[model samples]
Target: MQSDICTIKVRDCSYIDIEANMAIVINNCFISTNVFRVSPSVASDEQPLLSYSHTHKKWLTGRYIGKLYFEYNGKPHCFEVQPRFGNANILILLEEIFNIKLAHNTSEYKLYDNSDNELLKKIISIIWVKTLSKINIHGLPKHKVEKLNKSSTVRGKIAIKRSVLPIYKEKYVVSKRIEKEVDSTIVAILKKAYIILCKDYSLTESMLSDAVKEVIRVPCYNKKVITTNQFQKIKYGAIYANYKEIVDFSWHIIQHKKQSSMHEMADTMGDALFLDMAEIWEKYLFTILKKCFAPRGWHVYSQQYRIYQNIGFERSIIPDIILEKDGHVVVLDAKYKRMTGHFSDYDRTDFFQLHTYGSYMESHNKKLIGLGLIYPLSERFDKEKLDKNFAKNLYGDSTSNTWFKVDGICLKDSHHQLTEQKDDFLRRVESLLLI
Candidate 1:
């Protein structure tokens, strides 16, 4: 790894001298871990995003993976978090989430490198593709734009101030024409970004498809130089949410390119691009279960919140996944932890947490039929052993009772390729979560 770039896995730790590296500190003591919460958002008690051990001279990572950039002493530094299971699984996760294929290169795994630029670029391209696809569906958003044109005949409205000028006495009349056009700062930036990405980052028409590229065929540059500030403030309807996302990615691409150009920009603190792996796992499970259970009229919800109040105080508890079909309700928490199918390998905290969640649901919903935990099935773990251990954990519970269970999703095949056993995994999950 490069001296300037340090890489670690999610939920792992790294050695970074906090006293030596002052740039990581957004404030006096606290280091900013999230991109959005650059200033004031501190970690909640339940989710300790990041921490440092001064005595150990190490920075402990939370459940986040991506690249964070920091600058100190006129030098740029990067703190990267990767998945413990390696690049393939992370790629699969991204592909599934984005609903796009990110072609994998074998060279990436042969030797680890400092720059995660390739992965970052793939993500940017995928975002671009998604945005372009939406644009194709919604058509380019039209905006009312005013243009000043000089004509012999009067136009929409004569510019009184300009028409009265001495230079325009017997010449052409200056008029402002307000016309609706498929052009804006957002479109301009994305157009420029498309060119930059394709020319410099190997983003191809083949990757984005000819149809997607046709959406931005005509360059929308209105000769306006879009700054980072303008890019950040690009506005769009809440209905077309991808517009803002595309603009954000474009800005990142532009800034990254500028920063790579011989360090022309000043050393400054910037936001990091990261994804919560555990959240991704939860979302993946929710999406899969929703698809699998949709025909049966089951509704799947992610991060459903419930209030628990005692005496005068109230607390909120959120479960990862909840399913409702007819009058039956099932709550499940997706865990991205390492499991070895051993009886003692389970965490007691998870059991207690699920117990609280189940108890709340049982009391409130009366139709609550099940509660469960789901873990990823890796090549390192045995599914039969996991089932046996899970059954053993349920010691005195009746076999017929479907109140609680533990299950696994086969996320990888034996060869560690993309998952081909999703049907099997979904079947197991259905059997465990539903009676």
Candidate 2:
């Protein structure tokens, strides 16, 4: 029965039950343990997905969002990790970052329920869009298929029975014809994926109409469930390369199964797909900043390696974002954490890290213009009550002759369009870097 499945949903970096068996499952492979004791050091191999603090008697979650299903103590348990901002925001961020279309009005969808399947389907659909968009005029994958034919001359293997036919056959020869035909394996998998996402998962049909038309163009492409062995046996080459990610996501859908079959308790452990919020946050900031600054000849780079030699070895420092234009350089670190504009609210380590980056840039170049920390404005900061200047100039002492500043970017958009937030953020960043 579906009732037998126990699901525990938690936000990233939140606490989980101490009795829980913790594991980090990604793409189907997993590492799990029943109990994790707090130790001074954790070996790379011995690290558990959920770290336990023996002193606190709780397990701490990591930055991940997905479903993990396993049997512990003869009971089926599903661990679902969601983003701190909720499912809708993650979908919005993915749409913006990947430049793919997703369902609008995400709040109207079945997102509030405990089921992780909705989010999973949305992710699969996004992958489908991405893969399909890359297709050129060459269209779907095709392979050489051999067909027996009767022709005037020999082409492949001659058909003995057809050649020996009594009627008019002396002038005709039966041979095999090798023709390039659309690959049935790939079409079948994609069709099944579409049905699972649109029909079963209740994804809006219009959202995938273009993709549907693409699949429908394949003549007589039958939608059928593909077994694991069948999928594994399919060969991949350059022609079918773009379909790889969509197929993998479809396979994930097959493993999860429908709610009606929850009682079966199949050996399929289901799928796990997670995005690190910290990394996504960094990338999101980089993308927006680049869009706003790149038009004016500002070069924006992310995770750039700056290698320097220690006394005995080589070391490198990778700062999140670096903006340079005409030899004027600005070093900034994107912090996903909330900011309240208080000096004590800032982390000492983060301050030191940014300071180190600024010092390094200044030492290497004479024209380091600004050093700053860009953080997300807390949800509690009502956008309506705040002016544009509130987004920046949070706390700084430029009069002290150090162009170091703390800035906040509003992450929430009341209209859900993000136009205002993005515009404000761009203006704030430009002011900081131009100074």
Candidate 3:
């Protein structure tokens, strides 16, 4: 049945049993694991409308941003607008990451909030700008060559040694390395990205069209393998600050059609809007903690490999953020979901995970690690600052649960100044450090 809210028809389906446990995040939208099923349109570009689900009521309890893609009734299912309560703060963070201030408090922001269209546009703008500005700064990409092509120029100097063999001069003499169009995989990937974005009719094609002439000259990529080393080279390169983000976003969209991963939108749909809300929150926290703690002779690390399941190192438990100091170790877990102090099953799981991390850190270093959970301090949660304690060491550690608490910290509060929030958080963190 068509939902009354929008032009597109909304359908309901039984949410797959396996996916029922995970809050799938895609395109910066979150779909709850508890939802039975949602209705999504395949050709979002053609309809330019979002799906409405009857079952979203069950799991859509709080303000969580990011779209979730699911297949039901042989069609895609999604929520049109995922509530982003901390939009103001998140926009500020993204702006900082992009190194540019966008019109957040303006009408464009309103349009994005209401329509969910310009949100992706803003994301792509970051990618396009960062990509074009740095793509050629290092000069056209180069590759080593040992064979001669039809138009190959032989390096007479190097070829002189092999000139004794006639074929060496004709076939292998032009062994000199050169920067050519065909060898530049980066350019090929960039060109493909431009074309892929252009194909997605929903997006403002002009955004990519503007970049076509600059990157279109590179030859198409004939190889399928996208190596880890290639991305690392671009990431560590001295180019745009957000170049890695741009490259990652570009590659995901380019590869989206190829790998749907159940949560992925159909490549035939052609539009790509994906953001891992969880990762974003973690990274944002890392920046804040790293900046504040760096001057104080503290070290902050992400995915600190502190635990492994087996001696062979086959399984691992790498927490998002870890703070190491002379006397104290703090494990900060960043959960993207909005909370009101009423811990849900998911929140409990997070608490246990943080507890496990603490346990591991303590056993490894012979020191009790301070645990902290940081949730978004939105207006909804701000009202219900109900004095709540979620876990008293849910990991069977009853003796120390009460005295040594796992502090639950909320950040990005609209009610308080950013500095004030940081001060409050730091205070809480200090108390944890004492124990």
Quantify all predictions' global Cα lDDT against the true fold: 0.59, 0.59, 0.48
Residues 330-422 of candidate 2: C-alpha lDDT, one tens digit per residue: 777877654665554477898788878877777776477766777666543354434422322213534434466666556563435455766
Q: Summarize candidate 1's per-residue lDDT along 1-435 as a digit string, tens digits.
A: 235544333332223444434524422222223322110111222233355655555655555566656554556556566655666676676566555555565332222333444454555565566656654566565667889888777778988888776335677778898997775776787777787778655466656655566656756756677876776665566555555545665665665555454342223433344555666677667767887898788888755454745636666688777788776777788887655565644768998898787677667764767777887755533566645545422234665354566676656623244455656667766765544
Cα RMSD (Å) between model 3 and the true structure? Answer: 8.7
Quote each prediction's TM-score. Answer: 0.62, 0.59, 0.62
The window of 10 residues in a row where model 3 has the poorest summed lDDT is: 36-45
Sort every candidate by TM-score, greatest first: 1, 3, 2
Candidate 3 residue lDDT tens string, 1-435: 222222121211112122332233221333232121111100011111122234443323222233333444455454433335344565555544444444545432342522323455455554454445545455444444455433245542344554445554555442333433434556656666666555541334343333345556555664565555775465333433434444555665555533443544433322324344444456666777777787877778755453444667655677777788784677778766645453442456877777788777777763555567776554322323422433444334566542233333344535356546656666656555554
lDDT of 2: 0.59
Off by over 4 Å in 3: 1-78, 86-89, 96-100, 103-118, 125-128, 131-156, 167-183, 201-245, 260-274, 304-314, 326-328, 343-346, 379-435
